[model samples]
Target: MHIAEGFLPPAHAIAWGVASAPFVVHGVRSLTREVREHPESTLLLGASGAFTFVLSALKLPSVTGSCSHPTGTGLGAILFRPPIMAVLGTITLLFQALLLAHGGLTTLGANVFSMAIVGPWAGYGVYRLLRRWDVPLMVTVFFGAFVADLSTYCVTSVQLALAFPDPGSGFLGALGKFGSIFAVTQIPLAVSEGLLTVIVMRLLVQSSRGELTRLGVLLTKSATAAAKSGAVAR
Candidate 1:
């Protein structure tokens, strides 16, 4: 969920901005180096950005009046590097705020910290670790997405707690109430995202085997291909 502008107090925004600065810097530097050294990096990065925007537009209803959209970060990270995905996520969020009115400018940094920087890195980390395991790619993707989605909500909860410290609501209380709400919606949303990511991965492995190899998901490519082929025949 996009935190509206002015929803976060100025102090909270500034503080979180300060805290998240180093991670942002690291991501930018890492991406810049990749783009400069490898010519294809820039193009792939741009493509990921486009895909991120398109995926965000495809929303699934989570509750009566609200919806949750797939992040697309997991697929991006699987294809490219996590640092660039961070940049892509931030750029996507900015475009949504400016052109699509999905989020606000004042709260852009806060949203970036939570959804962009945190989600991609968290999911990518899990994927890297679990890629060696015996579990299915879909299952790994689901857990990676599950953690990423929940992490976004966790950071959002912290931001809200800091920005809107009700006279009676303590830190743990804020986490419980607000965090629980995101949990209810994001759990299913995460599962859906994982399933979509797995399907995409399977298709890519079958249609563009070389590309998946270049991206270093070759083992996963084989696994997903076999899994999909089996499912199709069944």
Candidate 2:
């Protein structure tokens, strides 16, 4: 979802910008380190950024100042990590704001805070938690993407509600209104994004098995066997 230009109050915009700066800065460092250490990952990283840009650009009318769309952060967050996904998501949002006018520059900070920071972190957390409990890979991936897509809208609702609370019912009422409006479109979009992410992950599993294994997205049979041998030796 994108917040149109000048939609947020000046104070709210500035507050969001200030709040989001550190995460973006840290993301920049993380992205740089990833590229430096694993130059081979550059291609996949570019693909991740492109995926976010393409999916999020398909915005549909939703809440007044915002729109609904797939976030496309979960795949990258799973393949790389949330910190790197933050950088990818920021770049995607910035381009969309400048080229497509889908979102506004003034609201970039708030947008990034939601889609880039919170969405990826929340989705990755869910994926990791589920994986630890021995959830199936594709199942975890689906939920990861689903959460990432939905969580962005949730944060956007909070931002809008805070900026323009209901006169009669206050912030809670405003939050409910915005959240309900977003959910109308966001739920299906989240499910679609989840399935799409699983498809992409399946393709990667077939074509980039080595890279996926290196990234710990998959474990090769040889690697598994080696690990078992090592454990036996120990």
- Candidate 2 lDDT over 1-234, as tens digits, reads 688888999999999889988988998999999999999999999988888877886765553555567989999999999999988998888888898886778899999999999999999999998976668999999999999999998999999999999999999999999888775569888988999899999999889998998998787788778867887798
Clashing pairs in 1: none
Global fold similarity of model 1 (TM-score)? 0.82
- Please give the CA lDDT of all the candidate structures: 0.73, 0.88
Give lDDT for model 1. Answer: 0.73
Q: Compared with the true structure, what per-residue lDDT tens digits does model 1 show for residues 1-234?
A: 678877777877677667666766877897888778776656656766776776667787775346777677777766776776777788888888899878788788898888887877788888777875556666776667666666776777777766666567677777676776665667667777777777766776677676656667675657678867877798
- Pairs in steric clash, model 2: none
- The C-alpha TM-scores of every prediction are 0.82, 0.91
TM-score of 2: 0.91
Q: Highest TM-score: give the candidate number.
A: 2
